[model samples]
Target: MIYKAEKFGEKYTTRWDNIDVDEILSSERLLGNYKKCLMDQGPCTPDGKELKKNLPDALKNDCSKCSEKQKINMHKVIDFFKDNKTEWWAELQKKYDPEGIYLKNHIANNRHGDKNDDKRDDDKKKEERDEMEKNDNKENSR
Candidate 1:
């Protein structure tokens, strides 16, 4: 059984950010475990099982009748990525990323980031040249 988010939830504007994880196993026992990690209180399901221990055969046997529950879980998956591909994430990405120049290209209304990037690079090169000139001046004075 394939646990597809599209099977339950509304289609998201952007594709799911499957940076690391992709599909959820529809096998009831495995889904029960993932639900445990995403929950805050009580068991992952109303039956009060599987979160701390494996679900009984009755609860972990199938998901044919789990449309609503699957929808709710898929919605959570989308919300979990709410900060992704947004301005806040773009800022953080440019700061931590080394090579990928995605912020200005992908983000909307982001001339500021590109402008600042160019300015910083120019300033760095100018600073290096100025320091070299200072060294040369000191050698001449000596």
Candidate 2:
């Protein structure tokens, strides 16, 4: 289930229905901080390098100051991401998920598996070459 930033202790660990978590997540400033922290520039890069590690959360804007509109912008975005499953919770990533919470296949968890898959092609090529060399040697001997 989606959660409010506060629920996980943006202030304290308590369930809050009055505060809109979506808005907090959707805040451009907050999202930008998330982008920098997660290094989620794009699906790929020319060099595929990561952004700097552990950008100070102090660099991100104070969520306590977020305006009402910023908060409202969050609702649809969170719902959209949850429904699509590609978008992710950069802010709420460490926030909280209650016990037995239902989960979805989001981009973050999926990316690690992708790196292993990228090696499959190289492995296949090496195997093919080894097989070809074996066949060539066998043919020459025959």
For residues 2-62, write the lDDT of model 2, one tens digit per residue: 1223444353212333545456455766544544444454342211121122112211322
Task: Compare the candidates by TM-score and give the number of the best one.
Answer: 1
Candidate 1 C-alpha lDDT tens digits along 1-142: 1132244443221222332233444244544454443343324532223212321111223222324443344333322332232443343334333243332232222344445557768999999999999999999999
**Each prediction's TM-score versus the true structure:** 0.30, 0.25
What's the true lDDT of residue 8 in model 1?
42
Pairs that collide in candidate 2 are 22-74, 23-71, 23-74
lDDT of model 1, residue 97: 33
RMSD of each: 15.5, 14.2
